[model samples]
Target: MQITPDGNIVFILPAGPLGSLPISATIVNTWIVMTILVVGGRLITLGMGPAAPASRWHLALEILIEQIRKQIQDVGGGDPGRYLPFIGTLFLFILASNVLGVVPGFTSPTGSLSTAAALAICVLVAVPFYGIADQGLLGYLRHYLRPTPLMAPLNVLGEISRTVALAIRLYGNVMSGTVIVAILLSIAPLIFPILLQLLGLLTGVVQAYIFAVLAMVYIAAAQGDEPGAA
Candidate 1:
């Protein structure tokens, strides 16, 4: 067993004008996770009939949707319908990626800083996008200068800092968990590692929830609403 759980390079493209580009295990695993989510989503939504008695899968999906809607409404203080799809997809993708690490040969893409950074960048962009959409461009830009024009640079810095924090927080947790598990396997009994694996699974779920919630909070803030408002 390896002492360090670094991502393996799966393939390297020939050097071009840009340079040789290597696809790492994290990228490959992320692709797998995306494919799984897309196919599973399609399968789950197929052949729906409103008049028919709901199957367990359908019922569970309904409950999940309702819960997400409620959470968005509570945090964002407006109609939740528009935000549902983006927030739901973020939760499910992260949840799936984290859980996939439990499999024997799979590593969570989130353990890689690059992957985490990419996800954070998406949220960073989305926050501004939604803010500008909700408030006009001038309205959204004016917030940075509120109270005083001198505070504008500080406000911009805060946004950048938060985006960096979001990436690091998720990457640190997932990577540390991965490293701890690897270290345990190297020095501890197999049974102990099994227990740690179980704990890691629970932690993975919690991390996913926290990441999604934080993203929602940031979005709500961008919308100029109290994050805790109903």
Candidate 2:
């Protein structure tokens, strides 16, 4: 594994005679996470009938979905159902990416600026999409010029800054955790480093939660307090 300038560890797959794709750890791990989530989601839904036995996976998924909805409601986003898919997807994908870092030969895609930025960009694009969808283009644009048109430039800048902040925050925290653990392993007792890694796993969940919460807040702000926007 080679560390990139951004501090992400990456593995370059060997090229094939037939021009094989060059894959990195981030891409491979992300695909793995996505596949697992997809299959798990299918399995969880398979026994939805009341006559079917409830399993631990279904119970956990229920708790997660309920919590996501609760958080959305608490934010005054109204009718959490509409926002559930977007917010829930963000949390699950991020949660999976972060939590899976504990596996051997694995590093979180969130540790890469590329992946973090891509997720942030999704939120960035989603803001205006939801805003326009709820408030109409003219209505949404009007918010930027509120108080006066002179503030429009600053409002625009704030949106861009938010996206940057989201990307850096996720990338920095995950990257630092990986780095610190690596450093400790070299100089500290073996078991101590392992303990720290387990702690890092919890930290990963916290980071994912924070990112998801912030993204939801941003979306709600963009959507204003429209009852239907939720």
- Which candidate tops lDDT? 1
lDDT of 1 by residue, 20-79 (tens): 988778778889999999998778877768777777888788999998888888888798
lDDT accuracy of residue 179 in candidate 1: 78
Candidate 2 overall lDDT versus native: 0.83
Candidate 1, residue 195: the lDDT equals 85
Model 1: how far residue 116 lies from native, Å: 0.6
TM-score of each candidate structure, all chains considered together: 0.93, 0.88
* Candidate 2: tens digits of C-alpha lDDT, residues 124-226: 9988888898899999999899779999999999999999999999999988887888877778858877997899899899988898888878878886764
User: At residue 15, what lDDT does model 1 achieve?
Assistant: 81
Which RMSD values do the candidates have, in order?
A: 2.0, 3.4
Report clash pairs, candidate 1: none
Regions of candidate 2 where Cα sits further than 4 Å from its true position: 1-21, 226-230
Give lDDT: candidate 1, residue 160.
Answer: 93
Best by TM-score: 1
Give the Cα error of residue 213 in candidate 2, in Å: 0.7
